[model samples]
Structures are given as structure tokens and as C-alpha cells.
Target: MSTPFDLAATDELLSTTRAVRKRLDLERPVDVEVLLECIDLAQQAPTGGNRQGWRFVVVTDAEQRQLIADTYRRVSQSYFASRAATPTDDQTGRVRSSSDYLRDNLERVPAMVIPCQQGRPESLPLAAMASYFGSIIPATWSMMLALRARGLGSVYTTLHLVDDGEQVVAEALGIPDGWTQTALIPVAYTIGTDFKPAKRPPVTQIVGVDGW
Candidate 1:
């Protein structure tokens, strides 16, 4: 169902749910209903064969989050070291700033949401791959969209993949063995909402004719 909100506000929210890091208020707590409401919205996204192969693993305990946070930091340091090596031009500079913000504050964010797919096939036909990803990616985006609406912010990050510690983290959180952790999202309230749209090239520049 559509929100009972003005078009302009809807458009603004659609355009501006940025991957907030430094601006995420680590000290503030996000309520349970807000998270559940977002997940409910996420359930509406299209899934292949209506199989709906996605699962979300949310982490809230301090000890578990601490372990996950340490793993995140270990990988984040590598990411930022390379980030630091990049040329400090306008675009890279912005990247560097965001990287710094995330590196410094990833641990403190109030919640961690890990969106996973139901299965991990060793190999698949190209068409199968398309269908498989089609199932979960939309739900993930819907989750992000939901987050934007409820005065919360998040970033799609996968640095934890470097550790392959999902089983350990899963054990810590009591998540069953079959589910794989695809991406880790740190959810929290933003300090403010005055975000600007990211700069990108015009779509026409990348669009192709029938013949490439």
C-alpha cells in the first residue's frame, strides 16, 4: 500500500536515503516496531516463482555485535587503507570521507541486519542466476526504502565477507546453519535529514541502441 504522504515528500525520500555513516546517531535507540514495519514493506518485493528465497538475520546483542564489529573493523581497515591510497580528487575525496566515517562508527550503530538468500548453489545456468538474484535483491532494496521512510538510515556493506565468519557469527546469534549472510547493514537514526542526491551521469549516456 502507498503511504498517505505528499508526492513531494515521497519523491524527496525516494531520492535521498543515502548510505549514512557518520551522521547515524549511534547513541540513539531504534524501536522494534520501526524495524518490523520496514521488514513488512520488504516482503512486498517480487520474488522468482514466488519462492521468496530471502531471509533476514538481525543482530542486537552487545557481545555478538561486538564480535561482528571486530570482524567488520578488520576488513574495514583494509578497505580504508586502499581508500587512503586513492588520489584525493573531488570524487575520491568524498569516498575517503565516507569510508572514514564508516570505519570509525560501524560498530556503534544500534542494529545489524543481514539479508540472506535461502540457498547457495555451487553453480547455475545464467538464466537461473538471474532468477535467483531477482528474488532477493528487490527485497533488499525494499528494506532500504522502508528504512528511509521510518526516520532511520543504513548502508549496504559487505566488508564482513572477507572474514567468512558467518557461521561463527551465526552460532553466536543462534541463526541456523543453512542461511548465508549476504550483506551487513548498520541501522540507526540519522542526526539530521538534509541529504543531497548523489551525482551521476545522465542515463542517456549509458543507454544503448538495439545494436551495440
Candidate 2:
């Protein structure tokens, strides 16, 4: 039997869709239509009860991007300070460096996307919270995959949504109440598209049979 899709290409796409940072081409401009196309594809993802309440707030205005970037940096300062004070392995250190770079250059990215859902999960039960997030996460990931397929790179960052930062960004972006922002994704073309699959533990080491 043959596969319905190109297995090799599918595997490559799945494996190589990395969380890009630092390598984002800041000088290149990304078309708004491309983002709209990716969002259209992402809308195909399943939503709770098919409500499809996901909303994407894209920031391309210089002032708005600057505000978001400033908010993110202000929130990340303490985090990066703590990480700098602690000991970390080489891989963790490298990740921190790249994240810092992204934090510093966030405003310069071609675009910023805030993936939002219609309901607030503030005091929802565990299951309800899961359902709430489950609705948006898949769509956001689909958008990321779509971005990768179209030669764009994006990194999912949530630092700006911490504590009062979410409200600050919301007010800045004029997002009405009752909606929760899931993540801030900075989108741009990649400097090069030669990303390789990251190293990971063997599947057997992480997977449980029927129970953990």
C-alpha cells in the first residue's frame, strides 16, 4: 500500500519545523496576505464544539510593535536575570542566548501575531482550562507549521502575557475584554531554510505502554 501524502516530505516538514529565533530575517518584509493564508489554513484545525473562536491580532505598525517589544523586555528582564544567576548546561545556555537575542530584536521582526481565544480561563477547572487552551493551541501550531511551509519562521513567546503584561498589551492593541491571548509569535523570513531536526531522547524512553 502507498501513503496518501508524500511521507518523506511530511516527515521532513514535521521534524524540521523548529522554534526559530535569532535566525529570523529582520530586514526582509513579509506579506500580510501570506499571514492571512496561513491563518486560513490554521482555521481548519478542530475547535471545541466547532466554535472556532480563535482570533489573530497581527502587529505591523511601528509604534505597536515597539510597545509590545518593550513590554516583553520588561517582563523578561527578571527571567533572564534569574537564568543568568543560575547554572545551566551548554544547550540551555545556548537557548537562553538565542532567546535573549530575540527579546532584544523582537520589534524589528516583520510582524507579530497574538493568537487569542474568546474566553478567559482564569478560574476554570482543570478540564475546562484544558478545553479552553486545547481550542487555540492546535490552531496556533497549525499556523506555525503553515508559516514554516511558506519559508517563514516564527517563535512562540509568552513572556509578555505574564501578570499585568497581558492587560497592558491588550490595552495597547485595543483587544476587548473576555478574550485571552495565548502567545506572542514574532514572524519573519528565515535567514536560511536549512534547519535540521533537533536531538531528542529515544521514543521508548518517554512513551509509556498503557500506564506510566
| Top TM-score hit | 2
Task: Please state the error at residue 149 of candidate 2 in Å.
Answer: 0.6
lDDT of 2 by residue, 1-212 (tens): 58799988888889999889989999999889999999999999998889899899998988999999999998778888888899988878888889989989888998989999998998999988888999999999999999999999998889998768899999999999999999999999999998899889999999999999
Model 1 spans with C-alpha error above 4 angstroms? 1-6, 209-211
Worst window of 10 by summed lDDT in candidate 1: 161-170
Question: What C-alpha lDDT, on a 0 to 100 scale, does residue 24 get in candidate 2?
Answer: 96
What does candidate 1's lDDT look like per residue over 188-211, in tens digits? Answer: 988886888788799889888896
User: Which pairs of residues collide in model 1?
Assistant: none
